[model samples]
Every structure is written in structure tokens, then in C-alpha cells.
Target: MVEIRGGAATSLDDMVFEFLEYGEESSPESSFSSGDGCYDDDRDEERSFDVEESKAFWDEQMKLLQGTFYRTNSVESKIRQATKEVLKDAAYSSQCGCGRLRVEAGGGCRSCLRREVCNRLMNLGYDCAICKSKWRSSSSIPSGEHTYLEVVHRSNEKRGELRVVIELNFRAEFEMARASEEYNRLIGNLPEIFVGKTERLRGLIKILCSAAKRCMKEKNMHLGPWRKHKYMQAKWLGTCERSAPAPLPVGNAARPAKSKASMLTFDLSEAIPIPGLRRTAVEVGVI
Candidate 1:
């Protein structure tokens, strides 16, 4: 229902999705309507244009996604809100984790670790997204210093504007569909982001995936990649890329049960140090 525009520049995902969808629609229309074989060649040529457009869009997107963070609602707030939505969706008893609904929350497997397992498989060890979510009347899960969701918010005192990211605990850390969007799909455990990290990152990933499921479930919406905002896409694609956030090692096990991959073996063969993406001097922030 909420078509995100004007609040900020359109995201790269939005552009890519829009472009892809338009190309798909135009393909059928532009083709068969060409009539006789004489004009058919011309029509086919048009399709090549579409192909070029799509390829160009995706190639540009890869650069953006690989870049630094984009500017949107306070990164801290958006991430915090998005994360909480996912966790709240998880606490629900009605949604399912089946592959039934792509965007909306659907079934009962949300709370199951198995569902999380399957999601990891889908995301290539990234985050565990709910397969589906069921409604619940009571969602009173235990709360504590360890149990509470970690959020980073914007600091009023910061120059320009700074979002308070929930401190992505890459150490503990961690969508879908539309014929238009691109997804990192796997049939089954945590996606790429969740395979390793701290409790903070893992916790944040849990919340985001859950919210994403719910958002899609309710309205058939998709969280297009952050690169959709042309501004963000450009920022992310800037000359100086930033390093991925770090994890929270000290408090790794505060809630190990919620994270299954915590037990997996990671190949530390290359004791590579942190990336130099952050060394560049740019007005960028990471959450």
C-alpha cells in the first residue's frame, strides 16, 4: 500500500525491478504484435534493447550493492524497526514457514528451528527468514539484557545525519520475489550473512527476515535491494567502499539456542584481516 517514493530517491532494487518488469511486459507485447516476418526482425531487435537494458541494470546494481550503505530513513531506525518487525512476526503462532507465500506471513513454522534451518539453506548461510508466520494472541517471550533486540538509532548530535544501527554484530550476525527482483535463493539453512558472526548480527538478521516475510505476506511487497535508491546505489558504488561491520564476540552465546549455525565449522584457513574499505575518507556510515 505504501509506494515508497519522494521520502528519498528510488532504490536500485526498485529501479531494477521496475525495469525488469517493464521489459517482461514489453517483450510479449512487442513481439507477437510485429505481425509479418518482415517487421518481425525489427520487433526482435527491440527485444535486444530490452536485454541490453536488463543487463546494464543488473551490472550497475552489482556495483552498488558491493558499495557502501545508502541513505534512507535513519539507517539505525529503519534497521531497528525492520528487525523488530521480524522478531515480532516470529513470536506469532499463526504464520507458517512453508514456501507457500513469498512475501506475506503464512503458516506455523516460524518459531521452529527447522524453518530457520531451511532459510539458511536458501540464503547460502546468510539470515534465517521465516518460511511463513502464524498469528498469535500472546507473544511474551523472555526479555533480558541478552534477550532484548539490539538497535542502533540516529544520534542527534552527529554531523549531517547519522543513523543508530543496532550495531550489526557480524560476529553474532546475519527476500524475495516479484518477477522483477533478484534473490539469493537456496532450497534449504541460514543464508550467506548468518553463517558466522556475533549475537548482535544474528539477532538483527532474525528480526529483519521475519519482518520481510510479514511485509510480503500482508501486501505482496518486496524489499528491493538498498541500491534502488539511485542516491544509495551511487553511494554504495562509490570509489571508496566500506568494510563489512564486525561481530560481537564477547556476548556470542547469550542466546545460542535462537541461532543454529553457531555450531558450524568455519574455514579460518586464511587469517585475512579486516578489509580496507573503511580506510577511504568518505561521509559514509555502517550499521
Candidate 2:
């Protein structure tokens, strides 16, 4: 079951969202662990992260999800992105407009014309006259502003359906580094590293979402190191969340061809795994 909090969403089918990175070079920088404690460490962070580090991390994550379909080319992806943008712009302007930039065409409010533009783009989807018109900005953030991205696969229309919202943890980058430490410690011994750690990764994800929410809402982007902050491990993030269901032990099945569009991905790919043909431990000739 894939999950995210906050408001942004995207969907694709045939493949689950392995992870998605928004900016350039998305394969090498993402540091991730499954249920493992890859970077758990005893030390506190003392260094500042590079501005590009986040981009690198996302790129790496996207690499992990390559060859999968997100239905991005479809109008759906455009719609979803537009929806989030509209909401974000509205929120930014309503909340004092730090994110709002220059106002060239939209309308009156010189104060938050930048925000108004975003709202307009979001409301209009890809039909935004600015994008097609290639309207120039007097002051675009030279360095791209930090943005949130989500990865998803198509949901079965046969089944009901779901909508996801994800919020990032401001401290996730540090936690990832720590998880890396744990991963290093247990290189030769996963069982030991994972002892009592079935859901460490999930807990970490929750913490990240909380941090991102706080940062976005306060309109301040201040962040903390990941390793120092401890996450609560005793609870599930919420019942509304759903993971990609699958065969008990193995991971997800391979995805179908992808064309970059919005889609819904399901974990249990068999649609209905055949009972008799189901591979069991004995079927592997292990028994």
C-alpha cells in the first residue's frame, strides 16, 4: 500500500510507484531502505546539506522507479499537478504569499500576483495560457524552489478507488543518512540490524510527512537533521493508508511498459494469483 499526506497526488498503472523524483538526475542521490535500518547511528548531525543533495536524493528515488508507468503523459497527470498547484498557490497567497512571485498577466494584486499566477495555472491545468504562450517571468527563482513529488501506479477501476496526500518530513534527509549508518552496521547481518525493526521505514516516512507539513504551514522552510529526531514506532500513520498488496514474501511484480502519465498501480499484480499454481516454498525445490 502506498501512502502520502498533504495534498499533491499523481497516479499511473501497471506498476507501483517505486518512488519519484521531480528535478534533474534522479537515480544516484536518493538514499533509501526498505524495512531495514540502513543508516541508524549514534552521532548527531554536524554538517549542512548541499542544496543539490535533495535533488540528488530525489533523482535516485526516481531511478528506483524507472520503467514503471505513472500515466504522466495522460491528461490525468496534468490535471493532478494543476490541482495541487492551484491549491498551493491559493494557500500561499492566503497565508501571506511567500511562494508568490511576479504578477505579469493574471490580474490586479501586485502583492501576490505571483501566487495568483500559480493559482491560475493550477485552475486551468495544462491549458494555462502562460505555459503554451511561454510567458516570461521578470523574476523566476534562479535556483528552483524546493518542490514535493509523489510516485504512484494505476488503481483498479474495478475496485473502489483511493486518493492520496503526502507531506514530506523536513528531517528525512538526516534520518536517511542515519539509516545508512544502520545499513552499514548490518551489512553482514540484516536480521540483527532489523531486529525489532519491522516498521522503522514506515515510521520514518510518517515523521517526514509531519515535518513537511509543519514547514509548509508555518511558511518557514527551516529544517532539522534526520538522525537526531526520534519517530514514534508504536503506531500506524493512519487507517486511510494502503500498501501495495502482494504475495507474502516477495516484492512487487515487474511493471508493464510506461509512457509517463497519471496511473494507478497495485502491488498484488496477479489480479488473482492462481491457487494451484501459486509458488510455495516447496515449489521452489527448497523443501
Candidate 3:
């Protein structure tokens, strides 16, 4: 029996029972709440890490691109300057030997432009030629062909010949219709016209391809086989055909034979004369 003391004395067993009941009721809820808090913290931490990693990746890419653009040698600069001059003159030229208008400010015929550039470079005493690279489809990539200009220079036998590639639409080559902002920004830094050595071009290709892979991974998109590094390298670095352009004809010999009635000034009446039909104005009544 329990003895009553002071006010009302409770049994020791009741005190222990009450404490146990309280613990049992609160333990699961408290533990569950703690677990949820820890999970949230971990998730937030992971997201922050991902964001930081993405930023670092783009920063590194930008640095590489800027470095590539800034590094240039005297040979590259001389050729680049000459190429620019040729492009300017071609853009303002009346027409090509084929009687077709030259390229305008924004756009024009790239084939003609290439021929003109090759000719101009050749006339300037550079060993220039139009190169075409074609590859058969393989297990990893599809068959494709590319045409561009190259200037080969051999300073000495020991140094071998250095190939300088000239690409007119260099920036467009890497553009994607569906790409992230970071990826597009990276491409925007590329020059519209690229004039560089094979080594420099190879480095640029590696940098761009790596950036493209990262972008696709971040967006959870599949990269196309054609856009792969191997494919891009194959365009310029693979087996190719080099063709020297014919020099532009001199004086009137360059123009082709023109017929009496050219397409631009052809008259149907003159070509087909109807026996009883005359050039007379006849009024037609509307029905």
C-alpha cells in the first residue's frame, strides 16, 4: 500500500508508466521529423554542388576559347589579312566569270566565294588550293563531305609543309538549333571566318566538342553522331583531294557567248510569231 504524504502521493509505478507513455508517443514523430530535416539538407547541398560545378565548367570553357582566339603568329596574321582583303574585294566585285552576281553583305554563293578566295590567295604567291574531304560511313559516324581552302607553306625541308585551313562559315558550322544559352554563347565567340593552322584548328575543335558534350549532359539531351569530335576532325584532317583553281580569264575572253535574246530580255512574240495575230489592243468584257 502507498502512504499519502503532503497533498496527494502518486505511486512510483504510475510515474514510470506516464514517462514511458510520453516517450513512446513522441519518439517516432521526433525521429521522423529529424530524418526529414537531414534529407532536405542533403538534397539542398547536392543541388548547390551541381550549380557550382556547372558554373566552373562554363568558366573554364570561356577561358579556353578566349585563349585560343588571342594566340596568333605572324604567318597566320599575314594570311588572315590577305584573306580579309580578298573577301572585301569579292563582295564589291560586279560579278564572277559566269555572269552571276557576287556575294552581298549578309549572304552569297559560297562556292563562287571559295573559288575567288582560292584564286586570290594563289595570285598572292601562296600555295593555295581547294580541298575536299570525303569520308565513308563507319560504325560510329555517318558518311559526309566537306570543301574548303588550304594554303600549304614549306619554309624549309626540316620544318615540312604547314597547312593553313580557311573556312568561310566557321561560326555556323558549330551552331545548333536547339541549344542552351551557355552553349550558344560559347559558339558566338567563334569567328565567322576562320583562318588558322591545322594545329590551332585541332585545338579549337577539341575545346568546342568537349563543351558540346557538357552542354548535352546538363540538358539531358542526346548528342548527334555528326556533331561528334571525330566527325568534326574528319572534315579537315582526313584524307582529302586538293584541286588548284584555274586563273581568271583575261579581258573579254572571260565572258561567255551571249545569244541575241537573252533570258533577261526575251520576248515571247519575237520567239513565236503567230501568222494571223497582230500587236493590237483588244478590250475584253467582264462577265
Residue by residue across 1-287, what tens digits does model 2's lDDT show?
24433211222211122122222221112222233534444211211243256444434433332322221233334434443445344433322233223232222233333334333543453222111001112232121112222223245677332222222222223232223322232221111101011123354444343433333323333333222222121122222222222222111123345655333654353556766665444443555
Q: What tens digits encode model 3's per-residue C-alpha lDDT throughout 41-97?
A: 666766777777787888898888776766666677677778777776766666665
Q: How many backbone clashes does candidate 3 have?
A: 0
Indicate the residue-level lDDT of 198 in model 2: 15
Provide TM-scores for the models: 0.25, 0.23, 0.73
Q: All models: lDDT? A: 0.30, 0.29, 0.73
Worst 10 residues of 3 by lDDT: 23-32
For every candidate, C-alpha RMSD to the true structure in Å: 25.0, 26.5, 27.4
Model 1 poorest 10 in a row by lDDT: 20-29
lDDT, residue 86, model 1: 42
**Which segments of candidate 3 are over 4 A away from where they belong?**
1-39, 94-103, 247-287
Candidate closest to the true structure, highest TM-score:
3
| lDDT by residue (tens digit), candidate 1, 60-140 | 444443221221233333343344344344334332333222232322332232343333223342222221111222232
Q: Report the CA-based lDDT of candidate 3 relative to the real structure.
A: 0.73
TM-score rank order: 3, 1, 2
Candidate 2 accuracy as lDDT: 0.29
Candidate 1 wrong stretches, greater than 4 Å: 1-39, 69-162, 166-174, 177-287
